[model samples]
Target: MSAARPARLAVGVVSAGRVGAVLGAALSAIGHRVVATAAVSKASLHRAETLLPGVPVLPPDEVALHADLVLLAVPDDVLPGMVRGLAAAGAFRPGQILVHTAGAHGISVLEPAVEHGVLPLALHPVLTFTGRSEDVQRLTGACIAVTAREDDEVAWSVGEALVLELSAEPVRVPEQARPLYHAALAHGANHLVTLVRDCAELLQREVLVATSTGSTDESMVGSASSTSAERVIGPLLSAALDNALRHGDRALTGPVARGDVGTLRTHLRELDRVDPELADIYRVLARRTAHRAVAGGLLPDHAAAEVRATLEEHR
Candidate 1:
């Protein structure tokens, strides 16, 4: 028999942190009833109060008892224990759906709830939450990754409906691949912040050096230079990202893509003279770029070999 149309269910949110509160509020705004939430911290409680005004803030067990769908928005480390605790407490009713916002975990963590007739799903929004009502609006048009061990038809429809209700796109990912997918996201987005911060510090040092040299550092000139840098860098980076997304590795540019040995050598020499630490990063990235370009048909095997040899020699 086809599963009953997944009801417009009442949702219970556990852990009223940024993701929990924002999602609860967004679902509520989209006409789902957020019946209860568990706010563990003072900050979380305040966030819940702000985002889910008039919604009862209950303990985890109480939330599970009151709602048909439960969202475990707790930290990844705490999720297994929390799920076990709920199961032991007889919190989930038969046929209830339980989900978590954890990207790194799949449905296995919810195994404790499975015997209780609870359907488990992993629904991770790709966008970051700002712990503000504005995030509810921002969630629209975002992308969410979903994985479930339940019937594919039911799981996919439920996930798609929820994402559509939130005005976001739903990408179905395999359960076993979720961790690796999450790792890729973390590596690109999270680590990039550290990289940018380092770049900003280097730029500030450059500014200080220019000022210290008593160069004709007019404020207008500095402002113009900063504006030009922003304009050029922003579009260049955007174009690079667009090309990567559209054409994959084939759209790579610069000396590495061209397999210019002299240019690679000059880059290493410049980095060594200015910042030896960055030289290693440059070399590694350049070598990878060359490999990708070669694979993408942008560079011949011999050219790639020459570039790789140049980088390895410098290293």
Candidate 2:
């Protein structure tokens, strides 16, 4: 029955990539037997050795053949071909549980394996992974996007149950919405990394320049400035993120939100002088932020017009 927890499954991970290795370990933690994993490349092999000690590393087809639950954790583009290739190889069996970790795909991509009568489900963990042991702990309280056939309640339950077994919350995503869902996550999480890194690099450059006047060795200065930059920005970025989450656009602050055109001009000039590309990025994002500030009623029409004019001047 759908309400029942999955019986202990012989789990087979198709590859020990970051997502695969971590999810395999999570399933193992929940008492599933990780019979084997397919890991190629030095990194993947090392990940398997570290995260899944004693598990046999085999080829993809062999791994699938050895398990009752086969996890396909390959890239989104590789997923369809892998599924079809495995199915053609007769690696999937009837009544087997076939799951993929590709966020952009739903059960549809598993159709080839489904033709073999496997129970197809898409269980995409919403967390980024580093293929490390700590990732297993991060699974707790994380959201996993679960997608099953619209009419298949049993499949839905199975997907959610698997997420629960990993100590994660399951959020149902309609098959049609997977692409947009994945895009939204990528836009936020991936772009946030770029944004944070840019900020850190700029801060580090400034710190290095300021500290260079001292007798400190160049390498030592660089190292110290990098750490100092992180220390300076960490709490500020954390609070900004927390406030944005809690207060929505009302959390908007700083020059853009205040519609301080003079301050905006200064930022544009500084960035353009030091990092022209970053200045271009700032202009684009500041334009968007200004729009949001106005929508949030934080900026008046006159002030927003001035801000827009200043940005255009910098462009």
Q: Which stretches of candidate 2 lie over 4 Å from their true place?
A: 211-227
Model 2 lDDT per residue over 124-150, tens place: 999999889999999999999999999
Best of the candidates, TM-score: 2
How well does model 2 score by local distance difference test? 0.92
Candidate 1 lDDT over residue span 67-170, tens digit each = 88899998888899999999999999888888899988999999999889887888899977778889889888999998887466786677667777788888
Candidate 1: pairs in clash? none
Candidate 2: C-alpha RMSD to true structure equals 2.5
- Tell me the whole-model lDDT of each prediction, alpha carbons only: 0.83, 0.92
TM-score of each: 0.87, 0.94
Worst 10 residues of 1 by lDDT: 224-233
Error of 2 at 253 (Å): 0.8
